[model samples]
Target: MGIIGINRSPSCGVDITSKNDQEVAGEGVFIEILRKKLEKNISIDMVGIKVLEIEKALIDIQRLINTK
Candidate 1:
């Protein structure tokens, strides 16, 4: 129903990603690809969080689940 990724990851980021040493706003490679693949059949929500902020990430996941 939802997807969660680490922010600033080159392959999994959802909101922030490292590009040539600078952080930019965009989805990472994998998430972007997955999104495109899913765009045709579903409307899943995706979110990103810092790795150290696992607690917040859990809350985000809960929210994603609740929206269903």
Candidate 2:
């Protein structure tokens, strides 16, 4: 799981294990790239599952946003 998380981080950029040390930028860009890569690697069935997980995470973010 740790390895997967690291691989999914924007820090990975276009490389498998490379890290992006951007001094400036929002997290959205990083997440978007990682998600695109993940979708490209997995099957359609798995994509659905990953989408659901993303939806849940978005919901959680909404909650946090509301709290702010």
Candidate 3:
């Protein structure tokens, strides 16, 4: 399964999580926990979405679905 999250959120960001108003390259706490918990059962592919990149995100999601 795949998850789409906001890029600027602290709790739900996938690739650009927020930290003290700075953008960092990391996953959110929940994503970290979920990854470990579901590592054995399912393939998890996550992507960060930005408001400005909605079109790109959609394309990425389509590609993910096609591959699966």
Per-candidate local distance difference test: 0.90, 0.37, 0.80
Model 3 deviation from the true structure expressed as Cα RMSD, one decimal place: 1.4
Q: What is the TM-score of each candidate against the true structure?
A: 0.87, 0.25, 0.82
In candidate 2, residue 51 scores what lDDT? 28
- Residue range 1-68, candidate 2, lDDT tens digits: 11122223344322223235533322334544656676787522111112236775455445544553
For model 3, the superposed segments whose C-alpha errors exceed 4 Å read: none
Which residue pairs collide in model 3, if any? none
What lDDT is reached at residue 39 by model 1?
A: 92
Pairing residues by index, what is the TM-score of model 1? 0.87
Between 2 and 3, whose lDDT is larger?
A: 3
Clashes per prediction?
0, 1, 0
What would the per-residue lDDT of candidate 1 be over residues 1-68, giving only the tens digit for each residue? 78888899988999998899788999899999999999999888998988889899889889988998
